[model samples]
Target chain A: AQTVTQSQPEMSVQEAETVTLSCTYDTSENNYYLFWYKQPPSRQMILVIRQEAYKQQNATENRFSVNFQKAAKSFSLKISDSQLGDTAMYFCALQKAAGNKLTFGGGTRVLVKP
Target chain B: DAGVTQSPTHLIKTRGQHVTLRCSPISGHKSVSWYQQVLGQGPQFIFQYYEKEERGRGNFPDRFSARQFPNYSSELNVNALLLGDSALYLCASGYRWGEETQYFGPGTRLLVL
Candidate 1:
């Protein structure tokens, strides 16, 4: 079974600064997908960014970008110019071609300071 | 789009009772999935349905069952509820079963006594 690992349990970043949350996964499948999801206190999960295993270029979504290393099986999320609204639990998830179910990491609590 | 919508923002049941949770997928989405999120843990996949057919089944037991309707809406039913079943039930929808991106609903909090 594939599993996602988020090494950082908690992280803080000052307003307008940049912060990165680390995530790694183990998968034997060559074709897969990595994702970053922002889960606010309301328990609503929102997609931040996604990276395809075959793509060498990282995925970027507005202020959110992904550092995807296929060989290393590492997919990290970088939040630039962090805002107060970024304060939430960030989860790293992985999906394969077999199913759409996401295997999520434990999550990293990001606190954007004012 | 409305993303995904789940019914009964909150639910409470006793151990040995049964519970049902409903969900509506996005307007153009044809797939729906169910997940359980316990406090301080990540959401675990329960079931996945696409085109009104069961596409994936997670490691959950027989106590957890779900089905999709013709309209792409879905319902998850849990029988003989245990306190361990108490968690946040989340519904996510996608264009297809393995589309990679899933839009999630606000989730229904289930509490078992």
Candidate 2:
């Protein structure tokens, strides 16, 4: 079974600054996918960014990027030029190539301060 | 295009009761999946249906079941509900069974007393 861990339960970043949310996972699969999802107060879960294990380059989506370290089993999300809209609960997820189910981390609550 | 849509934004039930949650996937999407998100916890996979066929199931007990329709819509049924069952039920859809991205719906909040 794969497990994802988000050590920080809460985080805050000033507007226009950057913040990084840490994530780690345990999985034996060599090929898989890592994803960061944002759930706002509206209760809608949105995909932030995704990284493929076989791809060395990190995934970037607008102001959202990921730092994926496969050997360390770490996948962290970085939000640059953060805005108030970035405030939400961020979750790290893992899915193996052979499976459709996603294993998610506890989540990190981020607050962007103006 | 509209995203995944779930019915009954909120529902309340009692122990030993039953509840049925519905979901309509994005147009042209053939894969629909169900998840339960307990307060303060990440969403847990419940079931996955592709092309009206059961493709995957999680560790949930037999009390929980789900099925997909030909239109790619789905329903999740829970029987003998327990208080522990009270949570946000989320529905997700993908273009295919193994597609990388699974778009999530707003979710139906279920409360069991």
Candidate 3:
């Protein structure tokens, strides 16, 4: 079974600052992938960033990056230089290396203050 | 070049009613997956199709069903809808299935009355 947990229900950050959302997941598979998806008021699930479990280095894209601790089963997302548009619901997801299903967390709502 | 697309951007149905949501995958993509996102929660996987075959199914009941067409388009059917069934239906497409970074559509919002 695969389970994901996002402890924070909500988070706030000022513009140009940084905010980190925490997530912990458990999966039986040895190889898998982790992802962060953002859902704004538009209700569309947009892919933010993803990391392969086997990769030792964390994955970063533009201002979005992840701190992936394989041993601890932690994958946290860091949004730097936050903008007002960054306000949204962020979800952490996990997919197995040999499976198609993606198990997701309870999501964290982020509010970016201008 | 177009991304995944879903039809009937919004819908409303009463209890015991049936609803069908459609999805069109990106060009050349072969896999499509369905998810249900209730308000203030994360999306829950429903179904996945690859090469017009059922690849995976989630914990949903028999009231939920889906099918994929030869063109890689898909439809999600929900019968005997209940208030709890109301949610945002998301469709994602990827090159294949496992380990693929799926791209999602705008989603279909269904309100069960």
Candidate that scores best on TM-score: 3
lDDT of 3 by residue, B34-100 (tens): 9999988899999999999999999999999999999999999999999999999999999887889
Model 2 stretches astray by more than 4 angstroms:
none
Q: What share of the true interface contacts does each candidate keep?
A: 0.75, 0.60, 0.81
For candidate 2, the share of real interface contacts preserved is 0.60
What DockQ values do the models have? 0.78, 0.73, 0.84
Task: Rank the models by DockQ, top first.
Answer: 3, 1, 2
State which candidate has the highest lDDT. Answer: 3
Predictions in order: chain A TM-score: 0.98, 0.98, 0.98
* CA error at residue A36 for candidate 1, angstroms: 0.4
lDDT by candidate, in order shown: 0.93, 0.93, 0.95
Interface RMSD of 3: 0.9
Which 10 consecutive positions of candidate 1 chain A have the poorest summed lDDT?
A: A94-103
- Candidate 3 residue lDDT tens string, A54-89: 999999999999999999999999999999999999
Instruction: Enumerate residue pairs that collide in model 3.
Output: none
Question: Which of the two candidates, 1 or 2, achieves a greater DockQ against the reference?
Answer: 1
Q: Model 2: per-residue lDDT, tens digit, B55-88?
A: 8999999999999988999999999999999999
- Residues A1-114, candidate 1: write the lDDT tens digits: 899999999999999999999999999898888889999999999998888888899899999999998878888999999999999999999999767888999999999999
